[model samples]
Target: MWENKIDINQIVEIRAKTTAFFGVGAIKKMADVAKNLSSRGIKKVIVMTGKSSHIKTGAWAVTKQALEANAIEYLLYSEVTPNPTVEQVDEAAARAKSFGAQAVIAIGGGSPIDAAKSVAILISYPEKNASELYELKFAPDTAVPLVAINLTHGTGTEVDRFAVVSIPAKEYKPAIAYDCIYPLYAIDDPALMTKLPAEQTLYVSVDAINHVVEASTTIVTNPFAILLAKETIRLVAKYLPVAVKEPENLTARYYLLYASLIAGTSFDNGLLHFTHALEHPLSAVKPELAHGLGLSMLLPAVVKEIYPASGEVLAEIFEPILPGFKGTADEADKAFAGIRNWLDGIGVTSSLKDEGFDEYMVDRLVDLAFETPSLDGLLAIAPVKATREAVRNIYTNSL
Candidate 1:
């Protein structure tokens, strides 16, 4: 058994592009965060979040109290939802502009944080709409300051510059990664994550797992990504089941939150490939589908096809679950089988068919994969050539 070495009792300050505080009581730093923002001439701010995660998790009271204590003015935009739409961001940006919000405070998971990033941009440039920003019609060079109070153990938008927004009308879900989008201040308090439902817990950790897997094996793979990916997988393998079984286990939540953060940093440095490229379209079409579940459904098939190109690196990273892995091209089956079994053991056994997809949708998904903006960029980085035939075969095997 692995020993617990992380000191979750002490707040650790992570200084990356985004200054982050992580630990049990990290949310208490909201006062300091507010004061710092206030000192920066940011008197009026916009708080962006999902419908009720902030209130249900008790993060809202603390954050509101902090802003009030600092004598800062704030407006709340609570319409963000899972797979946040471009319209939601545009509306929030318009409201923030009308309120003269000088900065943005995003509280919740990736959906709200991602929306907040786009809102910040639109607030700065009232001339551009969400579509213009997302479609890259205009390259935004600056945005209003952002503070992220992350409430989940996945989707490391807290510390990363990437954000994903969807246009369900057009079935487009693309990602944006700009240096300006990194939050000015961020908090990840696992205490807030204990109430996350079991399925979401599993799905979010799966998202983190996907982050590292793609980060470690991409064409741009590097030592930093490899090291972080190995630890990310190790922590998720050890702690995800425990967190699922014991929902209020702080230690389990602590490590999983750490896993998610480093996983974010890993992919930020090393980039991603097949899984994200394909999963975006799935969730884009089926707005109810969780991003993590979509990625899990496609992972085994992707690993099978891509393993040969980076077998040694992948084998080392997945060694915990895929024991006795030989890191050879011939062991591709073992690599994917081990991953598939591990996913099943973790209660993520859903097939694409179970998610209301069928063979009929395969062709449409394939076209979306190729047509979606920024996805071709992801596919271009696959270690193996991502030909239409290869993409079609992977989707067929997934089904």
Candidate 2:
């Protein structure tokens, strides 16, 4: 048996750097926030977004209205996709450079916001490409300024400085953490999420739940972060189903958004484990699979896999939200089943096989999980060591 290696009473150092504007009709404050930007040398900005959701949900109109009202000349770039690729970020940088974009307004879900942050980084270093930016080829003197409008409740891209960039050519997806990518300010309006579809709402909420699970259980665990994770899980549990059942429930949307934000803060301080490490490769390889969907499919298996070493407080953290959950040796197994069942209750019942995963690709997924240097830090921080055979077994089980 693995020794009790995690320090349950570890000292905490929390770092929260983003300034946030949140409430109903919060998007209306964009003009005022942009006006604040002019004092900091921000003139023109790029409004980065996905293709249809903004238009379909009316978020695009609010974004444009804000820029125009402030006379903040902005370019609207709507090419972002789920699991945003490095090449796409490079394209956004090119647009920003051409338009002389002084700041970025990210106005969608995690993908667009993540792409916007990466674009801000690539623009600050005009001579380098996105890949080079990832390579840290040059030290940036200053980050290109940014404001994020979070239109989704998942990923918490608005609250953090990390950007997940994928390279299709090599099937690589790596998270980039730099001070420059942190939004100077963020707008998270629950009103915006009211129009979101049930699938998106539930899936993203699961993403937040997954964040709490992985962050709370990592070897870098801390008491404060676990406190945040426990509350986050409780909030997600109470609010997610209501949000799914009633998409227009502003109360549920507001609290779920808060849950995601708290989860982001927790993970930022305590970091993540191999659940996220394992999912990044799935999205990198498949591209069609959404991040949250992949997490839902993999979390049950992952919780069971890591339970042997990480189960001490997991039951306590989970019992508050998981149905019929008991804090025992089998608590991890029960918790995993409860979470998987809860996901099904919210209409997230698809497996990796249903998402086009093949058994033959297990080796590829395993290689990316254990072999990719981009994912090494997360795996290293895992409560249980991630071995080749172990990772392979997890991948196969997830299939």
Strongest candidate by TM-score: 1
Q: Residues 248-315, candidate 2, lDDT per residue (tens digit)?
A: 87778877988888888878778887778899889988898889999989988888778777776677
Q: Which stretches of candidate 1 lie above 4 Å from their native place?
A: 1-5
Error of 2 at 185 (Å): 0.8
State the C-alpha lDDT per candidate.
0.92, 0.80
Clashing pairs in 1: none
Off by over 4 Å in 2: 1-15, 135-141, 323-327
Model 2, TM vs. native: 0.92
lDDT of 1 by residue, 98-185 (tens): 9999999999999999999999988889989988777767888899999999999989889999989998888999888899899999
Model 2: how far residue 370 lies from native, Å? 2.9
